[model samples]
Target: MDVDDGRTARARPSSWAAVAIGTVAVIWLAFWVLKAVFDVVALLFAGVLLAVFLHGIAGWLSRRAHLPAGWALAVTVAAIVAVLGAGVWLIAPSLAAQVDELSQRLPEAARRVADHIERYAWGRRLVERLSEAQGLPQARQALLGATRLLSTTLGALTGVIVVLFVGLFLAAEPAAYRRGLLRLVPIARRARAATVLDDTGHILRRWMLGKFCSMAAVGVLTWIGLSLLGIRLALALALLAATLTFIPYLGPVLALLPAALLGLLQGPAMAGYVIALYLGIQLVESYLLTPLIQRSTVALPPGLILAMQVLLGALTGGLGVVLATPLLAALVVLVKRVYVEDVLGDATVDQGEGAPLPGLPEQR
Candidate 1:
C-alpha cells in the first residue's frame, strides 16, 4: 500500500508540470491564429462600435421625442449623412484643386527639400549616416517610399462603404436583436443581464456624444484658427483634424503637422502665428469643450487608453484603434459587475442593506 501511494504522489508533480507546459504551448499557438483571424474581422468590430453609438442615440430620441424607435434611428443616420454631404460639398472644389496642385508641386517640394538638405549642416550629417547604413544614393528614395504609402491608403478607403452599410443595419434593429441575444441568459439572471445591457448602452452613448462634440469643437476651432493665421488648405486641414480627433493625442498632432508645414512654407512669421493659434485652440479644447462633453462620462486613464490602442492596433491595425476604447470600457464595467460583484461576491455585504433580490417582486 505504501509503495503504491508513494508512486502516485511522485507522479502528481510531473503530471501537473506536463499539463502546465502543454497549456502554455497551446495558448501561444492559439494567440497567433486568433491574431490572424482578428485582422479579417477588425472592420466588422468598427461597424459594431458605430452601431452601438447610433443605437444609443436612437433610444434617446425615441424616449424623449416619443418618436418610433426606427424613425428616430433613421433620422439620426440621415442627419449624419447630411452633415457629411454638406461638408464634402463645401470643400470638394478646393480639395480637388489642392490635390491637383499638390500632385504637380510635390516634385518641386522634393527637389527643394533635397536642395535644403544638401545645403544645411545637420541634414548633411543625417544624410551621410543614412547613406552609410542603407547604401542608398540619396534621401529621395525615402520620399518615394512615402508616396507609395499614399497609394496603399486607397485600399483602406474601400472598406468604408461596407462599414457604413453595416452601421445602418445595426442602427435600425439594435433593440430587437439585443433582446434576442439576452434570451440565451438563464431566466433567473435575466434582470441582472438586462441591467448590464442598459449600462453598456449608456456608457457607449455618452462616449459617442462626447467624442462627436469634441471632434466638432476641435474641427471648428482648427479651421478658424488656421484660416485666421492664413494657413493654406484650411478647410481640408480642419476636416482632417476633426476626423483624427477620434484618435486622441496622435490625431491633433497629425493635424498640426500639415498646418505648421504649410506655415513654414509661407515664412517664419506665418509659422509663428500658426503655432500660437494652435496653442490657443488646444487651451480652449482642454479647458472648455472637453469638460462640457465629458461631464456625464468617466475619463479613462491615459496609460490604459494608449495601451489599448497599441494592443488593438497590433491585432487589427487601424480598425482596432478606432473601436478600442468603447469596447474596453464596456468590458471593464461588465467584468466588475458580473464577475466581481455578482458572481464571486460577498453576500453578507449586500444583505445588510436591502432584502434579497430573489424575494423581491420581479417588476421592482
Candidate 2:
C-alpha cells in the first residue's frame, strides 16, 4: 500500500507540471492572436464608442420625444447627417481655401523654424546626426519626416469610414448584441454581467457627452481668440484643434505645432500670443469644461491614461492612443465591479457617485 501511494504522488506532480506548461503555451498563443487582430480590435472599440454616443441620443429621443426606439434611431441618424451636410456646405469653401494657403506656406514656415533651430549648437548637431542616419541632408530629412506624418494622418482618416459603418450597425440593434454578449457569460453570472454591462454603457455615454462638450468649447474659444489676434486661418486651425482634442493629451500638442508655426510666420510676438491663447484654452478645458462634463462620468487618472496611450501606441499605433481612454474606463468599471465588489467584498467602489447623469437612473 505504501509503495502504491508513493507512485500515485509522483504521477500527480507530473500531471500538475503538464497542466502548467499547457496553460503557459495557451497564454502565449492568445497573446499572438491578439497582436494579429489589434487594429480590428481597436476599431471595434471605436465602434463601441460610436454606439454609446448614438444610443445616448436615441435614449433621449425615446424618453423625451415620445418616439419608438426605431424612430428615435432614425431621427438621430437623419439629424447627424443634416448637421454634417449643413456644416460642409457652410464652411467647406473657406476651409478649403485656408487649407490650400496653409499647405503652400507650411514648407517655408518649417524651413524658417529649422533655421532658427540650427542656430543653436545642440540643435545643429542633433539634426546632423538624424540627417546622417537617414542618409539625407537635413532639409530633405525634415521634409521626409513631415511627409510620413501627413501620410499617417491620412491613414487614420481612411479608418474613420470603417468605424462609422460598424458603429451605425451596432447602434441600430444594440440590445440584440447586449443579449448575445450576456449569453457568453456563465448562466449563473449572467444577471451580474448584465448589470456591469449596463453600467459600462452608462459611463461610456457620459464620456461621449463630455468629450463633445470639451471639443465644442475648445473650438469656439480657440477660434475667437485667434480671430481677435488677427491670425489667419483661424477657423480651419480651430476646427483642426477641436477634432484632434478627441485624442486627449497628445492631440493638443499636435494642434499647437501648426498654430505656432503659423504664428511665427507673422512675428515672435504673434507666436507668443498664439502660445498664450492655447494655454488659456487648455486651462479652461482642464478647469471648467472638463470638470463640468466629467462630473457624471468615470474619472480616470490623467497619468494612467497617458501611460496607457504610450503603451498602446507602441503596440497598435494611433488608433490605440485615440481609444485608450474609453477602453480604460471600461476596464475600470469591470475591475471595480468584478474584482473589487465580487472578489474582495468591497461595496464602496465609487462607480460614478455624485450628480446623476441624464438618461441614467440614480445609482443605489
Candidate number of the best TM-score: 2
Q: Give the TM-scores of the predictions, in the order they appear.
A: 0.75, 0.83
**Pairs of colliding residues, candidate 2:** none
Alpha carbon lDDT of residue 96, candidate 1? 82
Per-residue lDDT tens digits for candidate 2, residues 13-37, read: 9999999999999998987787678
Question: Which predicted model would earn the best lDDT?
Answer: 2
| Cα-based lDDT at residue 184, candidate 2 | 98
lDDT of 1 by residue, 7-36 (tens): 999999999999999999999898788788
Model 2: ten consecutive residues of lowest lDDT: 351-360
Error of 1 at 132 (Å): 7.8
Question: How many pairs of residues collide in each model?
Answer: 0, 0
Error of 2 at 321 (Å): 0.6
